[model samples]
Target: MTPRTPAPGSVTEATCTRCQILKPAAAFYANPLTRKGLHSRCIECMKDVGALRREVPKTTAAEATCNVCGWLKPSSEFHVNRRRFNGLTNRCRACAQDYYQAKRRGIIEYQRQHRWEDARVRMASDARRRDRKHGRESDIKAKDIVIPRACPVTGKPIYHGYGVRMAWSPCLERIDKSKGFVKGNWRVVSWEAVEASGWQLTRT
Candidate 1:
């Protein structure tokens, strides 16, 4: 006579050699080789086997090398916690810095020569657009202040293009507040006159 299989709702006891306990048949794995009976090992043992199957051999520092500069660097230089590209940087630190500096200089020179006018127009349009979008007052204001007619100190005809109003003079280090070098006070002077006046330029 053939043996009857356990019913779905009924429980069958099975012994685990590892845990040394008599557990329900559900706690062990089904083994076709043992007449479809529960295996001697429990579910926890199967999980440990699965973990061993998925583990990889760790690479040592001797196996790692920098892609750029062809240097055999330590594995510590690369981060292993990353999930992509075997956790390695494409370029070494020195090579990466050189690449960035070259790219930056190229961009700066190109923008300085080619994009000044277009950039200025775009910036003005963007400011106006932002003001309209947010319903805020635009800060663009007109300056109607008069240009100094004569060199206040030198008493000479200050060249329109070479003097203060024409050329840009950065703010000085020390302001002569008592001598009226405050707001709404400006004067045109020659470079020699400025030097003779002993005014020091701010380092910025």
Candidate 2:
């Protein structure tokens, strides 16, 4: 038999397939792909079904399949997820690690490519890291540091960028390596001045 199609904007009522009861169309969730443009089951029935599915324990053997890589591996290879009855993630450890590493590399590359846009932020971050690494009670404030328009030593205009080599970029220098990144202990100096002073910037 052909299904009765309700006129548009007049679907005030529908039937829940799960509960086998007539109910308001608003009780069902919208589903554009369905014929009626609404779920056959009411929202309450759907919620009950979801709760039942969550309660049902998943069966797992000593080996499990990684949903991502489609590879069968030992259950120990997956991370634990309390929500799952099997207590293991669908993705194996190797696949999860690879995914995270790729995500991290992409972020690093993005930051490196946009370094010029965030030079001042990077300078402050570096200072804070240095302070923490040295166990110093000093703080680095972006507002406190003044970037000079020109190199203090050479009287040349200062430049800031990611691709700009250290020899031409603005650099944060510590007057004394033993000192922390305190207000009086650090200075914004050109990389050329640092090299002229026989000091090389240390890689963190």
Candidate 3:
């Protein structure tokens, strides 16, 4: 893979493929495979990369940083989150649990104050995100979600309850599970009805 000899009065400089910067031929490592007989990256760029690799501990290179504890921990300690570049959550499991509980309290209070009609305000983003994650089509919005006074399946009153008493709690159901939350494709039903229908809690 010998490079052709440079012509007389040939250019003495070439651009780095990595940094896209023009530098002297001496600034690059020899590469017989390339037409210019030089490496793709400049010597300085290669050195910087090698230095960074040396600085990071090999055993902890795949570890993630916890947003709450400000500590580097094993990536397994973080929940899987497709939204992040690293495919893991920013906070550790303990911190994420605490944050979820706090957010749940706020959501419950808001729903209570709004008589549950405003549950859509909190779920609109979740619906949109779920559609994108599952690669489904949807045009649903916060205003499109309407909570009924009674469950469509069980004909029971709709209200929130704790633990096993959540049977009567109102939950959204997609008539076509393969499809997204589009208009006329979903309804409000009781959790008990969902259980009887062989369905589990979703869109949460």
Candidate 4:
């Protein structure tokens, strides 16, 4: 027997053989070959087909090209992208790195030659700003603070200088050698008030 056709604008109900559920004609695809009119597969099957379509590869041979080198390569060589072009960078990665390094070196050389005076001025300004931030009393205390130490290598008096310190010491080896005496073969003698020490030369 031939299936009955629903009137125009009327709803026709069909059962999905796979899902075993009855739905309206809107829920199934139109099957031109089947007189029943509605597709055997249901909405769930259509959704699965859509998902598979999204997962399928869409790249073609003509799509793969490097923007920098203008070289035509395979899709594997290029970087991947979800929205736009994918595959490796247009210029090879090595060329990109070298370009950046050269630019950096040029900047360093320029700064080295021109920045010394500017750096000194900046340092002085920073010191003054730090002093102002800490207050004048802190600056005075720092200036007056004496570091109690002679030279670490030679036990000699350290003198205070303008915002700095200095150390003074005589080289015993040099003094002995100047007097025609070996460094290790020097004799120790005490000079009394009545006896004058061997012609001593004070360091000017």
Candidate 5:
């Protein structure tokens, strides 16, 4: 007797209205407005139509050319951009991801290089480092250090974050050479002030 049911891939196959390629019905998107309840074109062909309608070459109308890689790939490989005529970004998703990652790294580096560190934090860290270098570790924390707007010793304005120490840059120094980072013995002063007062600099 003849088989009662049709074999798979023989029936229920869909032909994309735009690409005109025969594909499985599962390839199309559900569309309540259509009689067949599915989009006329397959998912890829629907994306390709968006690019082709933007005045791209007809020969490659079914695919979009990545502006970065210059490779012709299915439009699905690109990210959507409502501002663009083609509704897709110039670069494919892979290339776009790489570009964004690099951009994020640059932004982080710029922030690190340009943003000011807290004056108290800088002084406190330097004190700890100096103490360690001289075999004299202290219990001083970052909060224990206080940085004033102007140097008390020389009465000069202190500046921060020009990427390097300036004459007006703040410096952490001991009020007495015999005391090393002792509570109430250390003060923030301008680099120039430290020089004028003949104070011993914190040796590395």
Candidate 6:
């Protein structure tokens, strides 16, 4: 369609609908169908809109708001989610971890109170449950597991069993899973001892 011709001496300048500023007609892109022979938005505003359409927020590596905790954090703190435009989870790392643990085991809040010691205790107990489900003999009681406030060896606080660092948290070690959860078969020990002995302690 051909653009409508402006009335005599009525087309010197036009108002940009977006920026609401009067600019020379040259500031707009030519549009054959518009009454003024140009787009409603000026060139600069149009360029910004175009860039927004093509941009990928997830690939930008900038700060983002976490939907769960309502905190603005670095992009790296979020887990990748294929469904989101930014390719990141709506929750930050810490919030996501809590949500995941709560959803799976429903003890995230309770475990957090003890610095996650309860989590280790539950892990060992869960093994016993699994053994019972599989019809394997398990004498372990969930209430029987004990978590010491400090490591018996190093006398350091036993926070949680995480990471491979020198001060890694304490862990539950089963002397023998084959023997089941019998009274003398398990103990809570520091991760350092387990690592030093080169023994991979199974959860059960």
Top model by TM-score, which number?
Answer: 5
Q: After superposing candidate 2, which stretches have Cα over 4 Å from the reference?
A: 1-16, 19-47, 53-61, 84-87, 117-189, 192-204
Give a tens-digit lDDT track for model 3, residues 30-142: 77777777878888888888876556332323678998999989887987765455767789999989999999999988768675545666556667787898898878887
Measured by lDDT, the strongest candidate is 2
Q: What is the lDDT of residue 90 in candidate 1?
A: 60
Candidates 2 and 3 compared by lDDT, better number: 2
Which one wins by TM-score: 3 or 5? Answer: 5
Per-residue alpha-carbon lDDT of model 5 for 52-99, expressed as tens digits? 676543232345789999998997898767556666778999999999
Against the reference, the lDDT scores of all candidates come to: 0.50, 0.76, 0.74, 0.46, 0.72, 0.69
| Candidate 4 lDDT, 112-162, residue by residue in tens | 544433433443344345445544211222222223334333344433222
Ranking by TM-score: 5, 2, 3, 6, 1, 4
TM-score of each: 0.28, 0.40, 0.39, 0.25, 0.49, 0.34
Model 1: clashing residue pairs? none
**Residue 37 in model 3: shift from native, Å?**
92
* Colliding pairs, model 3: none
Candidate 5 accuracy as lDDT: 0.72
Poorest stretch of ten by lDDT in candidate 3: 52-61
Give the Å shift of residue 114 in candidate 5: 8.9
* Model 5 pairs in collision: none
Query: How far is 125's C-alpha from truth in model 5 (Å)?
Result: 2.7
